[model samples]
Target: MKKIIRGWVLVFIFYMSMGTVYGTNTEALMTEKAFINELLKVSKTGAVLLTGSDEILTREKAATLIVNYLGYEAIAKKQNNLFKDVTSSQGEISLVSQLGLMNGLGSGLFQPNGKVTVSQGSLIINRIKNKLETPITWKHAFYAIQSSSQKEWIKGYDAISFGWSQLERDANNNFIISTSNTENDFKVPVGFEGPIDLAKANGVETYLMVYFENKGMLAKSFLEDELQRASVINQLVSLSQGMTKDGVTRAFDGVTIDFEQFLSSDLKELYNIFIKELKSALQKEGKKLNVAVQPTLYFKGYDYKGIGEAADHIILMAHDYGAITLTEVERQAGITTTPLTPIKEVYDALYEAGLSISDKSKIALQFSFASLQWQSQNNQVINSRAYTPSYDKIEARLSLSGSMKHFDHYLQSTYATYEENGIQNIIWYEDINSIHSKIDLAKLMGITSVSYWRLGIIPEAFNPLR
Candidate 1:
């Protein structure tokens, strides 16, 4: 009788050590059922491990399911041992940990046979599905500040490009220029002087943005004429030297060439020559040149290699791929909605830019802090407009309409839809998640700088740098 009792005690201890706990609540059971169903659909190993919805899953088995679903079972099995306590499932544990899919407990203990909690399961699932990473570290930030607002949002940044300096042509097409204000001196807008002082006070660099408007005609003509181009370059160099006021030295650190015209390959050489000459002039006065170019996928007028070598920073306007218009092929295929900056498009742009600009440090991936509203009917877009909405505005709109935002896995964008007055309204907007994902992608590609289209549109709360 003594020997039999001792044997029963040992058996009880062994069973308790297995950590076999059951999920008691209805929600837990349903979640477990759904998880098991998903696993069973993907992997055959679910047949042996997933017994019932109420049964708790061991951490080791959870790791195995993730590995199998990710098609990493064979590779997992080939890995060497990671944890000493995890003898049978060492390969799976090692693989998941290395891929950042899972982590071990303290003291080198993975608790392979321990019960997996609901939080752990949910986090692991999100890691595999969303491909999340820790917060990224960026070296520099370039912001586009609108001078009209006069609201200061340039607290912490490496540099800022601001102004509404528009390029125009007189009757003789003599390459005239103007600002957004009535009283403009040296092409400098009225309200921007204060911001330049603020930027200097905060130890942030400033760049006067030279806007090219009315398509590429004015800019192209200016570039074609050697004498006209020289005059404009000299004017820009003089503008870089800011005037002093009340014992204050206000000067721009550089000038940003925001030429967004539809120039073809024929103008590529002319573009390069203009940029080289401007860069040389700026360098003479201890200033820099920042060239904002359209993505390689859209325009071929930008000589990436030439500009990359001459300019201090090459800002890639990676947004607005399908913001305002869609191609004919897309219309025929019954596609209407488009994200402003898709993840794949950004990646492709970065890849193409990398091909020419070997120095990734000079590259700054620029995105919009705005949103696009698309009006569609019968799977055809009727009209679309882009606007910058504050965070409070977005939340208020969603709350009033009782609409929920949905995230796209492929595009890495957040969007919402609603029907009002018998018309469909689709909004593709930028939130913290969408913005951070792109920033992480840039970090992964070894690019450390990022720029926003303009400020005062996005509220101070949603500032990406913070």
Candidate 2:
């Protein structure tokens, strides 16, 4: 029912926008009236007085109308002059131009007094409407910097988290550093800092991701022990202060905690306290804190409200839905494929989190680039076993069996089934289209930040710069 209302609202908005630039006729005047009335009904802050449809709109007026319609009038009023030709509406001109809603005439001239054509007026109105619908203006990336093209994608993100550190505990339950997968001696590798420098130079914030990906995760115990948690927090704060690179000490803007242990709801308070203390510690060192959290759809341990208030950002790892949560009966009955990140599941997770976390801006939705494959024999899933296959391997499997990919509208994902010898392999993964669909949903929900799982596995054509 809510979706039906939303659809009608979109249709109404489109109808109203068409009246913004109507012909100078009695019918056009009626449409202009309807537009104004509809705009007033939808606008939270009262209606804006738009010029009559017959009146010629100047570029300055068009920009002002756009900024005002989007409720960015205050922000526009604060902008300084970007064009010498305009002064009275310079702020509006600058604001709209910066937002890509309008543009200058050329050669540092805004031509503020120039007439706005009907097409130009309609375009500006549509752009403003789009901005109001999806206000995403920032992006985040979880990077490994494994390939050269991976580094190239760095230009697209507002921030990047590199897995440069690992957290561990010794026999005494004391905090310690483990040898990083990317480098030995638990140090940032040489030449690896180049991406850091490049990211920083591009005005992109950098974060050191402190990971605990042990097969038998010791993180739960370490976090449960207050003393050990404090010790780890101190270590993380120190790392955030700076790392040695090329004879100079450079610091990341923040630290990201990626502890992969499943914390049950019983530990929710403890986990919230841990996050608060870690954030407080990092704050003392002038660094920010980011926590990667499993989606509440699967894990009820995370206190979204508490964590949202304490940390600068909380990345909801929204993938892996239905990956291993199959029932015994279903396993025996045989399954063709399981969705990795079902759209409805992701929606439910976000909606549940929104109930507790009032500030959605602090939330970053995660998208995975990996694929999960399951083996089937005799029309039954074998042991219900599933494993992640590389992109190349998935492609080769498809090529070998000549299996075509099918789009599952229900899941908003793509899947393929292939025969390997006598066994059937079913693969489910995100493609460019699926990722874009998720992104569209995220933006429609007013989410501004999105984080990729990692760099190398993402498609070559994927662009994060939107």
Candidate 3:
């Protein structure tokens, strides 16, 4: 009877141990399932992972499903030890394919028998966040998840906590934030959506994305709205930059006169009258009545002193050292003969005019990348005319000038250089090489800032200032 009791007791103990092991395994599976459910919920709008009827999955199967649904090629490559070799050429493509994100590929690769590491999960989640395009609602939710992911280097319970933190950060970053109540009174819409779309339209999507990431969700929205408002304000301000409107009178481009010729007595009177009107118009627009006057003209013979004294900011037209004309010879000399008459001449003239510009910050330096060319024939100057030369022709001319010693040094020097004349030809105007020089000059001059002759006329590189 005692032997029988011992056998029964041993059996009971064995069963209890087995039951404990099973319960632990069950709990682990439940935790993993819950984590995956969160991912699925977040991805509801576009792509989502499938769950089974029991809604419970094995560890291996759960990892496989994540790898499959996300199209995580990296995991596969890592599993096969193929990443080191394949990553160079086909890595990005493979990774995107594995994420189930390759458009039109129809959801490839969902494995069921693989375990997922915390690092792998974080990488996958981050990629999903990046793939989401603009007008991204719930952006804050993604941010919260990212924060959790970042702190996931710790193992076990700490990893779980980090993941939860990430989710929280994402939620706060996205849905909970509110936009400002201030109305953007501009004619066009102003908000995160508008600015994001505009950036995309302008082929500056990358810049916008960077700006968005750096500023966080709320800040990005505010900045985008402010930029849009500022753009509208800038347009209105620009209209008043060189405009005169009083009663029925309207003038633009510094032109003010009746049908009479320029600078006539009627023109001067009209200019004075228009200036007063411009001031009034600007005041109404809530902009300073800033006028861009020729620095030389303002100081030359004191004719423009009164107007310069009355102006808010004197925008010195320090560029246009060379002007385009139809005369052939003037087009080939390279450097402008009227150099001293404009930039250097005008800058000095402004100083001589005795106009006390208190704020040097208001002065803007205008510079150009285009150079003049003076063409000569038989030792005599040719008329102003433009000649469009192909690369081959330019190359040939350069070679000839280099070989020939007796040719005019100026012509030789000019021939050695090339320009795209951005104002006329929309080709290569200030390349990266020339832009460095311009930036250096601007820095050296201690000028308030530099302004382009025309915004649209310059290369995209010039948009940095804007």
Name the top TM-score candidate: 2
lDDT of 3 at 269: 41
Query: What are the per-model C-alpha RMSD values against the true structure?
Result: 11.1, 15.1, 27.4
Question: Candidate 1 lDDT, tens digit per residue, 159-227?
Answer: 888654656665776875555335442255444467777778887788878877436365577788999
Off by over 4 Å in 3: 1-270, 295-305, 308-311, 323-343, 349-358, 368-371, 386-446, 460-466
List the global CA lDDT of all models: 0.67, 0.70, 0.33
Q: Which stretches of candidate 2 lie over 4 Å from their true place?
A: 1-135, 145-149, 177-187, 213-221, 224-226, 245-248, 324-332, 396-401, 420-423
lDDT of 1: 0.67
lDDT of 3: 0.33
Q: Give per-residue CA lDDT, model 2, range 168-239, as digits (tens).
A: 656675777552444432346667678888898899999988776534345466667887887777777777
TM-score of each: 0.65, 0.66, 0.31
Which pairs of residues clash in candidate 2, taking residues 3 or more apart in a chain or in different chains?
Answer: none
As a TM-score, model 2 comes out at 0.66
Best by lDDT: 2
